[model samples]
Target: MAEGKVDPVHQFTIEPLFGTDHLSLAGYNIAFTNSALWMAITAFVLIVFVGGGAKQALVPGRWQMAVESFTGFVDDLLRANIGASGRAYLPYVFSLFMFILFANMLGLLPLALVGLHPFTPTSHFTVTGVLAIISFSIVLIRGFTKHGFHFFSLFVPHGTPLAMIPIIFPIELISFMVRPFSLGLRLFVAMMAGHVLLEVLSGFVISGTNAGALTFGIAALPSFLLMVGICALELLVAGIQAYVFALLTCVYLNDAENLH
Candidate 1:
């Protein structure tokens, strides 16, 4: 039981927060879970961070500055990737960026130390897949709404030889279809991998100390040091993955907003 508690894969479990069994809804099991709890927590944190910063002040405070910094960062990312007119989508892009950033960062909290579960919603493909679908759906809707049937031109490049049309179109269409899966999988895999590594090292620390003082020196100390370094790297990765997801979303938006 003690060993099972420290299992690396255990971190990803989605236990129901309320009832013992999952609820049924049209053949789907929909239970409020730890994952859902963390998502709510993530949303609450984002709301506070953004809402707290929306104060009218003569001289901006640190909290306000931090909010503005993140806002500007997203704005700049959009501008750089999608150009001047891209500011129209700032609300959507900013919300997406901040939510993912906060979710990734919040999941790293050491809540388990205080007897609370800390689940990263983004560590699950379902959450990330939904996010990717939202972004992809926006691109699809905007593409059709703005460009009409010309939106299908997205699958075809600016120019190509007549003979190459058959092959190139199919390949490009296939690649385009894979975007949501790739985007979601990237975040899920990155977040899950880090947590699994941390859990494994933590297990080593526990088991080594329990084995003997000699084994503690051989396994526990080195694993603890590596865990520290890995934690720092994971922090960096959390932010990077968020940025990459947002950046790729912006790139996809460019295909819709600019068609180039």
Candidate 2:
């Protein structure tokens, strides 16, 4: 009999879902990829969650209560940070939160079924980068609309000495420019690292089972334990990153409102 393939790290490969050539336009190649499918799934989940929970009541049922709690939490966060004006941005913030939370959770599922493929868009820089850019644009447009030409003064700071203006101005400009980079990188790195770790540990469990069934059986326990622990951690991260993104949005909105 042929020896079983023992290579590790084969699970993370990004393969096309269908045989069709990926759609190419300009320099960007778009495909009906697993990532795209999962993003759609995430959107569907958000729609269902919100739509199903639309009914309001003084005493709510399970779904209604869950949705109400989330809405209330976001409302409180906005009020505390952005004040009454924050209500205007609630829909955008809510959509962002649910989309991200669903995406991260869906990526944790068994994505290697015969007919279905699962992939994490959050692991891709392009997806995260786009999200960051959208948030950045929101801030920029709000700033420009509210403050007019004076918004550029944000880089100058209030108390800097005249001699340090040249030095400090460029630094502030660079920092502001890099906000999207930092935001995108933070979420991408965290999701990528967590998934990679889970994949490596899973590979060990599978490979060991082929080598020595009994010994591997024992070793598999820890792998399973770690997988569960990682799942919980990922769940926390999913909610947290969503909140961080939304919170930063509110903070930027507040800055625009105050012309700071």
TM-score of each: 0.94, 0.86
Pairing residues by index, what is the TM-score of model 2? Answer: 0.86
Q: What is candidate 2's lDDT per residue for 58-128, written digit by digit as tens?
A: 78899999898888888887788888988887887777777877888788777565555467778778888
Q: Candidate 1, TM-score vs. the true structure? A: 0.94
Clashing pairs in 1: none
- lDDT against the true structure, each candidate: 0.90, 0.78
Q: lDDT tens digits, residues 12-127, model 1? A: 99899778356879989878898988889989999999999989576889999989889899999999999998899899988888888889999999887888878899999999
Clashes of 1: 0
Model 2 gets an lDDT of 0.78
Candidate number with greatest lDDT: 1
The per-residue C-alpha lDDT of model 2 at residue 209 equals 65
Candidate 2 stretches with Cα past 4 Å from truth are 1-29, 111-115, 213-221
